[model samples]
Every structure is written in C-alpha cells, then in structure tokens.
Target: MLVFLNQRLVVFSTPKCGSTALEQALAPMSDIVLQGDPRIKHCTFHRYKWRLEKFLQIFDDTPMATTALIRHPQDWLGSWYRYRHGSWLDGTPQSTKGLSFDQFVEAYLAEEQPAFAAVGSQARFLTHPKTGETVDFLYRYDAFDEFEGFLEARLERQFDLDRVNTSTEMRLSLSAHLAQRLETCCEGDYALYDSAHAPRPKSRMRAFMQALAS
Candidate 1:
C-alpha cells in the first residue's frame, strides 16, 4: 500500500490486480510505503481505515480518500492458479501442479479451500466491515487507463508503469458447473465490479434547490 500524505490519498493493494506495477511506479512518490510483509504491504481498506489510520493519529484530521483496483472474479482466480502452478512453486503445498482450472476453482468454492485455492476475495478487500461501503474510487483492471488518468490528474504527475509479477500465459477454461459455483460463491466481487463501472448519482437536494431558485 502507498500513502501520499500531502495528497491525502491511500492506494490499497488488491492481490493479482496489477499492484506490483502500481507499487513500482508510485512508491517513489509516496510519503509512506508499506513493504515489510505481503500482508502489511497489501493491507485492505477496512484494515487501514479501522486500524492503521487510527494508529497513525497524526493524520487523523487529514481528508483522506481511498482507491483500489479489482478484476473479474474468474480472471482473478485464473491469475492465482497460473501463479501457483509456476515452476517456482512446484514442490510447495500451494502449488497448483496437477490441478486443472476447473479443479482449482472447485477447491476455491469448497467450504474449506485447499492451500492453492485459498486466495482472498477482492470485494472484501475494498469494503468496510460494518457499513459495507467500498473505497472512494474503484477501478476495473481492464480499464486501467482511466484509473491512471485519474491518478495523474489527482497527483499532478505522469506515470509510466511497468508490468511486474505477471504470471505465465496459458489458456484457461472453466467447466459449466465450476463457473456456476464460482459465480454463486463470489457474487459480491461481480457486484462490486459492476458498481465500479456505474455512473454516480447526482445530489437530488442540490438539484431541487437549484430548480427552485431558477
């Protein structure tokens, strides 16, 4: 995660959502960069707001905004499957070595997921625990250019992001049953992604006041 104190912006890192590229590109400009552990570095919005932010009370009065990127649930799982299946993880318990994508997804949807299919949900990462509110800005992985443009304008700097931590390319296909199970189990992720692309609502009271004055 990268925090810009002057800008009052916090970029929450969502796993397998191009976070490495973002971190590499923005770390140099950030005031506080979390890099000690994967868990701390990729701290979720809920954790940051409830725990980390409170702990860092120096910035309590700062008007902060949060941002995150999310990918399609199936594609997110596919990335995890390919990454764990790589040669580097061949002998590890987390290795997806002998498993097909369908099998991996089945494990993912199981009540108790196998080590290889235990990646956490993106929707949960960006949401508030009690209120169910998401980040101030949520970007889709496929629409990164839009996110990049917004960041550039907000930070007053241009970014030339390099691709990092990319998994090997492979064609992934899910069985109908596995796909259905994934959709049912990860419905929140799909809903969050859809919400990210939706248009923001106008303030009805402001519009009403303006119309009355006119």
Candidate 2:
C-alpha cells in the first residue's frame, strides 16, 4: 500500500499484497518512505490503538490518500495456512507444526457465529477508528495490471511488479464440500470482489446469449 504523508509520498505495507515490489519502486526516491503495517500487535487494546492514531496523525488532511491491495480470501487463507503448516493441499505434513487447512477453514467459517465474530475483526487502513467510516479507493489483488496503472497515475511515477512474489496458481483447489463451505463462510469477501470485478454490459450480454444457446 502507498499513501501521501505530509506532501511526501509514502508506502504503507500490508503482509501479503505486492508491498515488496512497491518498496523496491520507492527505494530510489528520496521523498517516498516505506512504513509497515502497525496493526500486527497482539495488544489491540493499547499498543495497536496508539499506533493507528499515530499513523493517522502523519497525514495532516492535505490531499492525503492510502492504497491497499487485497487478495482473494481463499488464496490468502491458503498462503497463510501453508506458511504456518508448510504443507500442500493434501494432509501430508510439510512443516514441523501448524493447523491444517480444514481446521483453519472451519474456525474461519465459524467466525460468523456470536463469539467468534469479534475475534478475527481487526482494523486496517481503510477502517476509521473514531468515525467508523471505511476509506475507499481499495484495489484488488487479482487485477495487478490495472492497479499498477492506478499507482502510476496517482504517484506520477512508473512502478514495476517484478520484485513481488505474486503467483497465479490457485493453492487449495477446494473440493465440492470445501468449496461450498468457503462460499458460505466468506460471503462478504465474495460479494466485495463481485462488485469490484463486475462484468461489463457487453460481456454480460454475451454470457447471457451463450447461456441461452447451451
């Protein structure tokens, strides 16, 4: 993620997204600085809250903006699981320790239930702590090409995606039951992605005709 801090362009990095590439792009520039996400603290009550407010203070409201790249939930979950467990889609243990994908998915899906909902609920750049207003201009992890253009236009500089570790391969390739469970569990993320990548009118009409022919 990238943002303008006190008239100097800065990068606010998230864990996965293409922060590595963005960090590389801004390296040569003296004005642009890179800052990692401050929400990684276990103490959300005090340390996290203080860090967030301090981050917000860096922007004095003079045309300040922040950019974040979000990946598909399934892919994100898969990567997180693999990083923790060091295992593939199968149950074979690749790592010394970590929860299985099934276990993570089950707990993630159950987050919608009463007690679990607030457990995983954490704030990001888009979220406002005091006003509860979510900032806009969020980009998709799937559409890196378009996002690159957005960065160039916004920052007035070209950005290269070469240094990033982005892979097109789907990780989990969920089975029927797992897919259904995911769809039900991650409904909100799915809807957001749908709205972001909604088909054009022409494409929609073409798909409609194709469906009719079938």
Candidate 3:
C-alpha cells in the first residue's frame, strides 16, 4: 500500500493488478510504503480498517480514501496459475509444474485448496469485514489510463506505469462444466468487477459489456 498523507490517499496494492509497478513508480512521493512481504504489500480493506486505519488516524484529520483495481475472475486465476508455474517455485509445493491450467483452477475450486492453487478470493480483499464497504475508487485492472488520471488529478503530478511481476503466457482452455462451477464459486468477484464499470460513458460501457459477453 502507498499512502500519501497530505493528499489523504491510499493506493491499495491489489494482487496481480500491476500494483508492484505502481509502488515502484510512486513510492518516492508517499509518506508510508508497506510492501516486501505479501501480507504487508497487499493490505486488504479489512486489515486496513481494523489495524492500519487507527494507527494512521494519529497523523491525519480525515480517513484516507482508497483506490484499487479489479480484473475478470478467470483472468485473475490464470495469472495465479502461471505465476505459481514459474521456475523459481520449481522446488516448492507452491509450484504449478505438471498441472494443466484447468487442473489448477479445479484445485482452486476445491473445498480446501492446496498451497499451489489457494489464491484467495478478490471480493474478500476489497469488501469491508462486516459492512461490505468497498473502496472509494475502484477501477478495472485494464483501465490504468483512467486510474492514473484520477491519481494525477488528486496528486497534481504526472506518472507512468511500468510492466512488472508479469508471468508467462500460455493458452489454456477450461471444460464447460468447470467453467460453470467457477462462475458459481467466484460470483462475488464477478459482481465486484461489474460494479467497477458503472457510470462509464455509454460507448465505453457498451463496448465493455460486449467484451464481457464475448
């Protein structure tokens, strides 16, 4: 997470959402940068509210507004699968070597996922612990240009994104049955992603809907 105290802004590091590159680009301007460990780096909505928010209150007059990004649920899962398949994890139980992407996804949909496919739910990350509160600003992960514009306007500074933490690319197809199961299991993530596109221009929103349908 990157917190700009004077600006009352916090750019939350959503997993697999180019947050590493964002932090690298913006860290110099932030008052606090929590990263390195995954837990610290990906400070979720609940963790921030229950722990960090109170600590930050000592230094601020008002609560900081959070900004984050979301992606299609399948895309998010694919990223995790590819990331775990990286050679760096070859010896670790987290490695996805030898597993098909469909199999990895199957593991994820299990009642209890193993380490390799235990990528947590995105909905749980963004929603409030009890109240289901969402971030003040949520953007589609692909909509970096608009997200950057919002940040630039608030911070009054220009910025750019660099590709970072990207994983290997491969075409993997899922069975229709498993795809249906995934739809049911990750419904919350789908809903949250859909919400991010609201209030978009008619042309853009229509195009987005078409893309989703396709």
Which of candidates 2 and 3 reaches a greater lDDT? 3
- For residues 1-214, write the lDDT of model 1, one tens digit per residue: 9988788788888999888999999999998898769899889888887887876666567668888888989999999999998999988989999999988998989899878888989988888879998889888888787888878988999989889999989999998887888888788988999877433344999779989999
- Return the TM-score for each candidate structure: 0.89, 0.60, 0.90
Model 2: residue 169 alpha-carbon error in angstroms? 7.3
Please write out the lDDT profile of model 2 over residues 175-201, one tens digit for every residue.
568768887766665655554432223
In order, how many clashes per candidate?
0, 0, 0
What lDDT, from 0 to 1, does candidate 1 have? 0.87
Tell me the alpha-carbon RMSD of every candidate: 8.9, 7.5, 4.4
The stretch of ten residues in a row with the least summed lDDT in candidate 1 is 193-202
TM-score for candidate 2, please give it.
0.60
Compute the lDDT of residue 47 as modeled in candidate 2: 35
Off by over 4 Å in 1: 198-214
Worst 10 residues of 2 by lDDT: 113-122
lDDT of 3 by residue, 93-203 (tens): 899999998899999998989999888988999999699898999999777778888899999999887998899987877888988999998889999999884334559
Answer with 1 or 2, whichever has the higher TM-score: 1
